[model samples]
Target: MKIHLRSSLLCIGLLVLTACQSTSSPSQNNSAKPHEIAALFNQSTPEYKPETEANRTDKNIDSDITSDSKPIVYDDLWQEVIANLAFDIVPTPRLQKRIDWYLKQPDYLLKVNKRAKPYLFHITQKIKQKGLPMDMVLLPFVESDFRPKVHSSQSAVGIWQLMDSTAYHFGVTTDEWYDGRQDVLASTDAALDYLVYLYQRFNGDWLHALAAYNTGEGRVKKAIRQSKKQGKQGYFWQLKLPSETADYVPKLLALSYLLQAKHPKFKVPKLPNYALTSEVDFAQRFDFSVLASLTGVSKNQLHRLNPGYLQHQSAPEGPHKILLPLTEKQLWQSEFFQRYFSQTYTVVKNDTFYGLARRFNTSVNTLMALNNKQTTLLKVGEVLKIKKAQPLDNLMLEYQVSPYLAQEEKKPVLTMEHEYIIQNGDSLWEISKQFNVPVKDLLTWNNLKSSSLLKPGKKLVLHLPRPAKTPKKPEPKKFLSELEQLVKPNTSP
Candidate 1:
């Protein structure tokens, strides 16, 4: 009887998995033994159905199941966030004051959640993968109010608030065309790398590490040294730092508490583990306008996700990345998509993918892939591969899929010429050195006489040389040794 009961339970479990109505054989008899019935349960298979075309083509697959279908008020990511918070910040009056500041703003929590909806899931998901605390996602909120294009008075830029020098030290590339410090995921990665470095530098004390992140590491270290010299312990709380630096850790802790607080005013969105499978990497330069048309995502939306781009187009030098819905990947790969709308379109107006589909006689799924694969539109009068067409989707921005995207204003450059004004203590040679051009070239570029004195604030034209090719590589050690041997051969004789 015990065996029969156990078998019955196992059979029920199997039935639940495959959605089968019964685990029993139709010809079962009362005389059948419990062991025999149990065997039938083990042998039972899930009901099979023909594969649907939707399954064959990912375009039809519903991303909205998680992105939009569920109620927006509840997010499982919050539970995971609260569960993984292991920070050692003790409650203090300063922290409470910061908490009061955050709480006082009626819209602050909502603002954070609203700006973070698209990225928080991905950030939190990555944090979990690293076994780090989930509250790290709140850093961007504290840094730039989640604004990617913001430039601080301190010269810090991007969501991570990384200064140009600091960004380069962390291996983030900054150039005229692109600044990796402003790139959303790229900056996040660099920031985390810096965080890990700081954590190790301070001997695993996160409080001090976080302080160092806001202020410089040297400042924090100096504070520690100064504190120890004054007979105070070299701890984060005890050390005297700048007023803003002192408030920094407490601010983070206060925000951390609010996220974990489960206050009724805050509604965590439904961000699942699979929310960020959309990010994809492309190893070549691509056009964002065509991508906007293809994916039906707005140009503004694309810029928000990839803030590193200085121009509308991607850098001429790339391996670029864009986030597309997972289901759209299949449709993008479909022959139908290739034949009809395989080509790209540039953004003329803020438009929806569905609107473009309606205007161009294409399917929404066909356009979804295009919208998500944006690259760049760098220079004006830039040769566009996709033909120009006035879009019929003027109201498409109303249905924009992305909630946050920075506006990119277009300014026409009338000429290729660059001008520089003379500054104090500047000479022709110094100006030449600043531009890495020969002084002769500078004179020629500006049509200046050799005897002319540079007037401060006078504008001078600079037809700079094209970027230099890499300098010649040093000869191999063995090659140099052989050269020395050749020269010294008479000594051996």
Candidate 2:
């Protein structure tokens, strides 16, 4: 009965794919069509595999169970990874080509191992929990070479190489102060969720899910439909896909094969099967410098573990968790540690509980509770106990950091000339607040008197601070003197 149901769904899926292909014109580029089909798949089928005793049975029973009921232990994580590989692929030229490419670069695996050491165990454990094919653990190797802070030309960031839209769709947050896409814990959860979603969307085809991950589900479904139209099986290998995507699945498969086979030419690096880092949850926003000082961990190590924090402090609005060395977990959880890290804020003029709540990314009720205040009213020059801490500049530069954070830290503040057109309902004071400039400064910049009448649609010259510029390397070029020297060499001694 189960087999029959699966067969029926497969036939329906094929029919839908082929029918969509038949109706679509060569010039038709409607992006909505693919999503419409995806929506159909979502509605027609269960989003997850049904739980059954047989399917729920652990596949790694050998290593996971023993006569005494104690699980067998492996010293190396790669060995554990090898024991659980579930995918089988026949060696083809394309697969061999990828394997050959890796074999030629002997140092590539070593570098990957170094970068992967901190996160691999955690990622592998997550895959195991999900009952996914173990090869999914290596997806980051192909995506970003295990670099969490890496960015692609397409604006994809992190080890998972998730684009902003996809990241947001999967609940990975991105903002000025934080980017969950680059957080190993956050991105891993989001990436795995997306993969599981794709797996179900493609009717349990892992290859299709992986290919879709590279190009997108829309394009992969379109390719499958085109293949079906041409009297093909519409399998991953048979479907016509973009060049990068065509190679993407094969590359992963080739790596999986090599790792499982333990190829003589290829050497796998030794990594412990235990987690190298653990998450430390905070009830409030914390400063990384203070974290470094309290935990005796270097700022560089903290930055590496918590790259999602764009500045020297955690996001004002946050998950409020940091990945730290497992050894330091005890230190972070100490009661004294929490008390020592408590921060304070002084109430200034025009400061209200509501305004302070928004500024500090907390709630007025929490503030009131902390201060034992009955009302939202606040006194000037009052000291309020706050959870958020301002970053110290001296501590921020104490150690080298990731390029992205370093760029953000050393970002320049430049003033640029702007021509603003006067709009309806505009006032000098309002414009000054809008641009974060004083009204007097605005008048001087525009060459206007205090009594000048504002007219709609009229241009006003204003000087405003420019956005932070990403530091770029100066392009190499030859000077005119060098060019002249090259053209005519001096013969004199």
Candidate 3:
């Protein structure tokens, strides 16, 4: 009787488990599973529809997260970034004074803070990467006020205020493709590295090193000597220094203090954390216009990301880089940089693939690639196609694309013509030797009939040769008779 009771109990337990499983996931039960049935029984479950799962997956697949659906402008991003920035840990007295100066200068103060906040955040992000202090970003405001194209009276430029020599020393290029001085990101890296060097050299006394940055180590040493002579304590402030150097560190500190004190008054924006996309080499000198034309991006867009470029074109300097927007870069990759660069023009009767290549300043091989054909054979009436001219690639030594005429690689003849403004103590002989042009040519070019008189701002065209066509119509024989008389006089004599 007891054995019969236990069998009945087992049967009852199996029935209960099956009931729970079906209750938990009735929609998921194509396969018979005991545990699944128990889970289904424990909770009220939403209907599991295969159609809904398929739809959800499809929705995720169709979504585009790389790019914004709507057009995004600087103003939209600027507002958020500026509102979130805060500066709170400055304590140097001179720095506080400088901060006071910044806060008081309404025109400079408000404009720089607003424009600089985003770039500062960018700097901070990079600093965080190297485990450095984020406050260093504020130093640029004192250096250049976040201006990308400012040239100092002392000859520093860009946001970091790097001198040309210093930039080159740091391996930053000053070619047509890029100017490290004006590039916000590159300049920041170089500046930070330089500062790190200075900090190490000066035993972490940032003030003395910063002063040395402006006035040089020799000047700083002189200041130290002067300070010791006067029996002063501490390093920079107690020492006598150049006015610019005296104020440099204080200026940095003041801005930091103001940001700390008035962070709420300051508007900081949030920048999206964008991963670097593609780093394709620009093996040729390329114009920013070409990138704009090819990528369907505006020149303005390129400028914002690449401020270091002094001009519209990039030096196809090997390793010339462009940090592209992720989605745009992806699109170009998908097309293998072919869509915009793949433009086609058909050959006319006068067309040889060589001629087409020359017209576009590309090679015959490149043209062949465009047409997907091998061999230079041409039919009298066979249609041929070619890529468009790309001058940007001209800067690259290896750029194979060229018009057939350009394949000959005509070396450029650089002719420099200068207009010499007569200065306080200058002479034609001196000017001719200085410019390496013949004195006779210089005088003739300028028509300097008077040997000694050159007024200031007088336009003197030098180094010009006489035209092959004619010499200034020789004082048109004002006298046909005089001319005859002068010729006949020789016979009379």
Candidate 4:
């Protein structure tokens, strides 16, 4: 990339020189009058300067600023990171290549770095607490490019790129209401724990641990066992791992090297390693809509700050916390809680969903989604969920039983089976979560193989489990002896 840039600059320089020579050459001045000639000669033709180092590049070194040992002077988050960076590993050619790639996209790295500001301190602090390799501080960049909510085809989530299984194994709960894997706090805690586990599992060899983090510890162990069969052992580079797994460590090391460069292309933001934060602790499960109304926090901003929440609302259990802006911490606590309440109302004649929506200042669609109701029908005297987490109501009972499990426990709840058409980008796992059904049951009902990919617009039959019935009478405990009694007095025996 640097070579390409330098070549272009050199080409432009040649073009400018050619144009200047054509316009100001002695031969070209032959057409000028005596006065013009005298003026040109008297003025002493301006000298054309050769390309200097400031504008020139080494092409091979790929940078104007050289040496990683010197202190870099850019005032930003990245520069501070470089100043504090401590790593046991050194740069290699592969690392240089990744550095070249990153340098080529000055805007992209800058953007991603800006996105990582909130997370860096927390992640680095945790890594430090665990005595992890400094290179791990930049692992999130290689995983998700620092995009917290970005998902992959492999179903990995958040900056850590933790798969659902890994996330769950690490106690990062994921369900219909929330996915802790996408939460900055939860995911970071889980990721560091998993990293620590890997580090210990591989006997303190960070390279193997890192590779295992990417490709799974089992695969790395298997590769090690294979290498041992050939009388080679405990060497990560010697193992024949998957292509991505092999390149994963190189990518991180390359980033570490680039970050330590004495000269950087851009300034990283100078953000504090620890930023002030305020926590809103709910005594019970709370409605996000009501919470938003009370606190004046927009749901969109909440979503950005709290991506772990799978639904708009937080989990329906106590000890659920929502982070609020530290600047308005006091206002949120004093003002919002005073005004909040969870209340339900009975449907009355002439009361419509639209009217209730207008009363609550919410949309009809939001009401339908919140209540899980269809159509505009409202029966007189029927109870409707107007609000949740009413300060005066029994907030404890609201979350004690999950609606998902409660509905399932009430047998014959589903009136009729239906066929659903698969949509674009739909996966069976996600679909099952949406419908609160098991993926295995979804496959069994459709008579499809587990490995089948869903086709868009393809109809899939859904059959709900039937309720269990009690036996009318006790059945006989007939065995070999009982069967002989039913026969001719056990004569044959």
Candidate 5:
């Protein structure tokens, strides 16, 4: 009877187990099974979706966490920047002072954030790809407040504030038509290359690299050597540096710290993670006015987006790439774009590729390729297509001048041309001081080098600003002292 009871009980247990398996949800069943649990572990992780406005909140930004408890990949570009911050700056008076200064001017930060939206994604992406510290992304903010076309009194140009020599050393070309220093794409690459080189040169010390970036590497090395001689390890903070260099690193550190803190009063302006601008390269030189018309983007906007182009048109040679709003990328690929911009000329007697190329402001190779010709030979009456170069005046009236171009326009044109012959013992410095111009400008104006020996009687061309007449101050009314008053009468008139 006991054996019979045991068998019945065992059968009941098996029946119960089967019933549970049948009634349980799939998820429950999976959780119960060992193999299913292993499969769950092997499953691919969920892909990150860009945060939507509905899902993004102040709490999400501050905590970087979702309601369901998943760590947010990124709520926006700012969040991404914050996540990648690798610096741990100890609080110092200078750092606190900078932080305090930034905190007081919340509006300034907002303005910079707004200006940075169009560029932050590209800059951040480059920094990420290079495995650089996120601090480098804010370097432009410190350099030029993110102004791509800004120039400093020290001759540093562009958002990177790259000096002329540094820009040239990094293969950034400058000419009357184009200044690569103002080209965000070219200058960013050059700046990062320089920073990486400095980082490596300083034995992987980022602070030292940054300081070297502010003041030259030679100065930083000298400071380090001086510190070492004084029986101290050469850290950036430990070494004595110029007031500017000392404040520079602290400012960067302060910015990084404040940004990471997620303060309520100081919020980073909302900018999407996606690129705001897309660079489109043309096969030949293109006109900005034509681009503006084609994309329905204003001329001012086009100029702001492509400040590298000094004039209304792109460089005659190449780098015919222009940054347009990413939304306009589709316009470039549309059939109408090609049909509208394309121009054709009928070949006449004695028509040659070279002549047509010169006439069209393009290259012979480009002309031949456009016409699908294997050789430079041209046949009469054959229609060959070319890119249209629009007239500047026709489009200049369509839109207001961009702030970048307006600043250029407002500059006092140095119209007065002067020819100065070098005198004996006249140094470039002395000549520059006498002319009230920079020595660098003197070198550039004369196509002379800093090391070039100035010879007597050598002529130098200078474009000086029109001299302003100084109003002579009326002679101060003569006042007689008490003793003089007693000695002589003073005129009241």
Candidate 6:
């Protein structure tokens, strides 16, 4: 059976925590296996409950910042936040320098203080729910800077930076509508669970566990073996590691330093702890406005709690959440759940099943089920039951393609093209020479004069030669750029 997490950030607050009783192994046996972490939880006779809540601080611990209403004094809390950032994971000088520079950036510090709490809270709660070390929540800062859309050079993505294979094993699907990697709450649970399992395998050594996170466990084991052969301790720092892993711990340490008391040393801002009231469940796709109308929450409040909704909408098939002030939970449950689906719309043009499905903040499969159809294409003039007018301006950001395409030989590769800014003293002539395009053709293509110098941030499109084609009849122009035609030289008729 498919386990669906609530996709919408609507009203419901259902956190699915299945206890594992250890059926078989996570190893493939021609049958789909439960995630290893889930399997482990299944093995326990009684579900394991973390003894302490992750984000709770002793009220008496320092009450320096007033209750939720008051803004935290940066100078007051920077020292504490930095001290709390200590981790055994990373330890490099270059990483230290990076953290220093990162903390010194005023804009970044402000964002960190303001936007990082929900992320911190989500991860910290997952850590506590799974009994993980609290320090691991800081990992996202290094991984994605708490940005949900971060895609790494190695194709690892999301805040926790899971690769496709690992994400699959951990139950994150890379489907058209959902990339579980970018789902902050889901990915945090998966990552923290993975971290705990790794920590157990490494005898609770966080260093080795972290190395497993950076480089796969198999490779880390190999490095440990080599370290032993060289009469070195099998510690992470001593083991031969990938360049990235070698720098990983250092980066963590640097991050810790930046969050430390010397925060002012880097002019770093202190982050305040955000208090969440409650998470309520909305079992169907609904618009943010509906949430506002139902729970008396403003649209801004809902988005603030659920920033992972990239298009400012929820996913389909009835698993959305609307985190609200605890006091509003009953108000939402009493009024919203029974009457939320009334603000519906009929399907219109440019509406694919998925597009309409997403527009309604529901799933394509759900729409198919709702309409009794199999394909994603919708019949023209088909009446779609939309929750709100379709969002015209903002769609999912087109996935970025690197210089190297992931798939082989797609047509019109320019769709993945990116722009390189022209720097000071750059000219179209120099650029064409650098990128190996003819100067006259480049000038004409970019609409530049012969004497015009390229300005910074100018967009240049590099056209790759297409396949050989039949020669066109010669035009009246003196000559065309060779790139315009792809034909073999003719020797004889």
Q: Which of the numbered candidates is closest to the native, going by highest TM-score?
A: 2
lDDT of 2: 0.65
Steric clashes per prediction: 14, 0, 43, 8, 0, 36
Whole-model lDDT values for every prediction: 0.55, 0.65, 0.50, 0.57, 0.63, 0.51
- Report model 4's TM-score to 2 decimal places: 0.52
TM-score of each: 0.53, 0.57, 0.47, 0.52, 0.55, 0.50
Candidate 2 ranges beyond 4 A from true positions: 1-71, 328-493
Worst 10 residues of 3 by lDDT: 1-10
Point out where model 4 deviates above 4 Å: 1-80, 327-493
Q: Across residues 1-493, which tens digit of lDDT does each residue of candidate 5 receive?
A: 0000001111111222222211111121111222221122122122222221110001111123233443235758877777657564445565689888788877666788776777788777666544455668899998777877665546677889888667655556677667787788778867876675565556555677789898998899999999889986676667899998888877777788788787776767777777878766665666675677766778789877877776676666866777776644465455445445566789999988888889878898888776778988778989898775443233232225566554544322312335688899999999899989999988997789999998898768675763343222222223112112222323678
Best by lDDT: 2
Q: Using TM-score as the measure, what is the rank order of every candidate, best first? A: 2, 5, 1, 4, 6, 3
Worst ten in a row by lDDT for model 1: 1-10
Off by over 4 Å in 3: 1-96, 105-110, 113-121, 262-284, 325-493
Winner by lDDT between candidate 5 and candidate 1:
5
**Residue-wise lDDT of candidate 3 within 1-493, one digit each (tens)?**
0000001111112323333211111112122233332222222222211321010000111123233333123333333222222222324444556655655564555566555643554565444333233346667766765767666656576778887656654445565435676767677766765554454444444566678777775678777778778875435557777787777866765554554455454343344443333334566556665666656667677766676664555654533566454444464444435533445454456567778777767898977876778787666656555554344444323335546534644432222234567776777777878877887887786666646586766657553321233111122233222223212322444
Model 6 sits at a Cα RMSD from the real structure of: 20.0
Candidate 6 regions with alpha-carbon error over 4 angstroms: 1-108, 258-263, 267-278, 287-318, 322-493
- lDDT (tens digit, per residue) of candidate 2 on 324-356: 766444544554344455657898999998888
